[model samples]
Target: MTNPAIEAFVQEANDILETLEDQLLELEGSSDPAQVDAVFRALHTIKGSGSMFGFTRLSQFTHHFETAFDLIREGKLAIDGKLIDLSLKARDTMRRFVDLGGDNAEADQLSEAAEVKNLVAALQSLTNVTSAPETTEEGASQAGAASEIAVFDIWFKPAADDLRNGLRPDLLLGELEDLGDVTHRLDLTAVPSLEKLEPLQCYAAWAVTLTGATTEEAIKDVFIFADDSELEITKHEPPVAASEPELTTKTVAADKGKSNKTTAPIRVDSGRLDEVMDRLGELVIAQARLNQVTTRLADPMLEAVTEDIERLLTGLRDTTLSIRMMPIETVFGKFRRVVRDLSAELNKDIKLVTKGGETEIDKNVIDKLSEPLVHMIRNAIDHGVETREGRIEANKPEHGTVILSANQEGGEVLISLEDDGRGLNTEAIRARAIERGLLDANATPTEQELHQFIFAPGFSTAKELTSISGRGVGMDAVKTTVDSLRGNFKVHSQPGQGTKVTLHLPVSLAIIDGMLVRLGSDVFVIPLSAVQECVELDTLETNRESGRSMLRIRETLVPFLDLVDVFNYPESKDTRRRVVIVRAGNAPLGLIVDDILGQNQTVIKALSVYHRDVEGFAGATILGDGTVALIIDTAIMIRRALQQAKAQEAPSKYVAAGGH
Candidate 1:
């Protein structure tokens, strides 16, 4: 079995490193003491805890870095560009050590590598101070005169089952020995007789007394990961002249009302959460079946029980989904380094400003967002943001700004990345589209339509290739990912101002509230988030005379698509057909269906390989009658209608010109 404590360290180290990057990037602009102190504390925790957990190499490597920050904390050193750059590099090295799981063959080799050696040397040069050697029993006695010595009384007893969970008290004791002059005695009062002994159980405990210039906090950290054990630390203050000895005793419990972890969150593996969601999806399907049975039986008691179950399931679903939801800031926090590095590499001054980071989305969606957002950021810098001199000439600030913002709108999350720089070159995009045979030469497409050509496969208007863009694959991949998530994107640009790309994505991909509609023999689900309103269709006003299918809701003439024609089904003979108006981008389109079924919770499942490539259907879900209903992708269906309309208009326009 994997060691839970080590796994916890890995997770924590990842978070610390991410925050470290953001902190270091901020340090470049401001030298706030609190920020510096925060950085120092983080490094000290990693170093101290790293040592206690068998990461000797990582601990040793981080000592030099910790020393540098210690000097900066003491006003012995100052922050500069060189220090920041090297510190960032050192932080990267620390991440590598953590990723390698510390104190292994790879980590051993990394410690001896030239880059690490050089990084350590550069950090050492910052303060010209080498780390004090590890405190030894004899060394502690000699150093006692130099600093006020602290005496600690430590006692710990591992839980009887801790050994089975991979807790090694010996390692914890050895780590404490490195802190100061340590002496200990074993307590075996709990040890059972040979006849009753359990081989894997821990019965012995330790009482250790240490004299060192270290706080009780440092000693407690030796057993930090052993949260299930019992631990106590007492400090003995030195006696004043002619005074009796005094002591301040603090009882620090490991698992029982532990001082440190009272408010700490319980970290769970996301894979387990996904598994719960899958089981919940099945429960939803079974609930649908139950609802169907109760409806047929028409029994009052069964109906009452069914209603209670429905109410409880709704609560369970909302609770489970909220557990999976995380703030978008988790992804947004990563790009500070990206922008900083890109600015330095491109010799441009660009600042990244983010807003609405508190908006939350499902974990699964956020996991896939980082890469596409990175690509978008890269393009914003490489193609959108102008050079410093160019900005000066354009009467703009020397520094370019890229703003990434996200917000929840109804049932969808809108994430937008916008930059202030010379915007899209429409003429260049249009020219490239025609050259690539993606657009007709004689066609007059809107600027918006022309701008979308950037996402076309193997499409670029760049004069030359750079390592970043001109490969023509980044935006295409982004569009593919967005579409796979059942989302759509829009691009808006002003020639002299900037370009903004906005992605509209569903808040949760696993389950959603949906409106059901029937098309011939098929029942289809439309995401309730996109559905505006439903109306009874009046077949008498077909508007076939105008050579178009349209509906006038109030006064607006909204185009409508007949499912009988769109899906090639037999014409619906029902005179009471309904039109479901759904929002698509900025326009509203009407979908004509044979009947309007009520709404229900939908569990979305990915399509099988055979139907995966097919358009218009997002996925399939089980209905109350145990039948499969195809979920309509509203945005895609509307876009398809627009494409078909455009295709028809092309033939009519050519015929109007009297073309044979």
Candidate 2:
């Protein structure tokens, strides 16, 4: 039989060991006594947990690592970077040993073990020989000395979430057989009635009595499955035999589990959740068809049933979407390792700070966002922040700050990567753009337009491409990845201040609340959150004297993008037009449309591989009537407008000054 308690212990141990190893590698250049102490605690936790789980091999191996580090802590061994590297390698070997089930047969495991033994030998040469085991309070406690035993009792209280993690109280009681003739007692005062039962909640506690060879450590291991449980272990001087009629351990244990087996939490896989979403989508479509039929029949009962089904479908969809949400921090947390390694390699003093990490995004989107975030951080350190000496000369702090934050705004998650460093160099960027043949020789672009040139392929302003950055790889990759996700990316900068890159992504790409609209021959879906208001466009009166058209909304002159001109659609040949006002970043634009089709809950489907690169089309969604409408990529459209705005602004500046 597989022991879940031991397996959980092994998994926890392995994860902690990996973190320790990564931290040790990060601590190579640091001489802080506090960090060394932290490293010792990590190894100590692994060793203690390993022995508890019966992984004797791992415990033995980690003991040596712990001893060597203890020597360093005590000043017996000198601190050095090479030693830290060796310790990190040994940590990796011990992880391999734990993974190998502590068996010594696999060639790779044997090789790693041999390497660890050699490293241990090298470390041992720096220490004085100890003929006998070192005596510490912990060692004395484990020795079962006659003076150490105390007479008391233990109360193990499991939390409600403990059972949801696959722990069973009765099964844990069964494992207590090793500590002598043990009697298990359980408390079950919180069990609710069947009607109010929640399967995931734990409703009991345990009391165990054991004799002979039993230590507090031994007793605690029996409840390994209940790690989050509140364990009160009062040491008893001698193992006491069960005697009281009211305290018969078997009777208490049996009674506790007897009344309640009715509910257990159901575990559903991700594939099943996706299946539920698909069924909900079909029901939504079917409900639309039913409403259409009922309109012709004018049946009252059919209308009521349709209303009920709509409510249920809406609930089912919400439940399914909630299941797919995971905190963005999971991906964001790994950047500590990246920042640590990059800072060490570059010899730069940089601190990473993250906020609003609890904000959730679609699981798929969070998974893909990691690479782009890493690239941006790397770019900030390599090219954005100045060198330590140079930064001081520039009257800035030596340690640069990079902040990654995410928060939900209405229906989309706004993630911003900002750095307090030198902003983009417009003169250098403009010159590079000309060198790359991306701009005219005599052209002068505004700061905002100049910043956009970095996203173009093979654009680098770095004097030479170092390992850290400047190879023209990461920025374009960020653009492509964000574009693929139907998200928008923007850059804002001010000289001598800082740069901020913002990414606006839908909460979940699979589904959204959308507003459907039509423009000439094509239909478009605007994410409902971005829609401010819709109004009629009487171009004849709204036209500028220079032939430009703008809509005045709330005393703001918002430029209107004629979808017909942008998409090359066949003109409606109508005198009047409808405009949908959408906001991206700080700018709002009026998108010309033929008609406002109604609100919809849309399930977005990605375009075919060939159409993936198509501009302005975020994704495709099927309408209630089965027509395919393209979801609008608002960010790309905004960028295109910005480019056009810049183009229209040029030449007129020189003419205004009478220099043309």
lDDT, residue 80, model 1:
84
In candidate 1, which residue pairs clash?
Answer: none
Question: Which candidate tops lDDT?
Answer: 1
TM-score, each model? 0.88, 0.71
Off by over 4 Å in 1: 1-5, 48-54, 129-146, 156-169, 173-179, 189-203, 213-251, 254-264, 539-555, 651-660
**Model 2 segments beyond 4 Å from truth?**
1-215, 218-272, 520-522, 539-559, 565-568, 610-614, 641-660
Q: Candidate 2, residues 186-273: lDDT per residue as tens digits?
A: 7777788999988768888777665555555456545543556777665544445466222211112334445564653344556786
Which run of 10 residues does model 1 get worst, by summed lDDT? 651-660
**Per-residue lDDT for 410 in model 1?**
87
Q: TM-score of model 2 relative to the true fold?
A: 0.71
Instruction: State the C-alpha lDDT per candidate.
Output: 0.83, 0.71
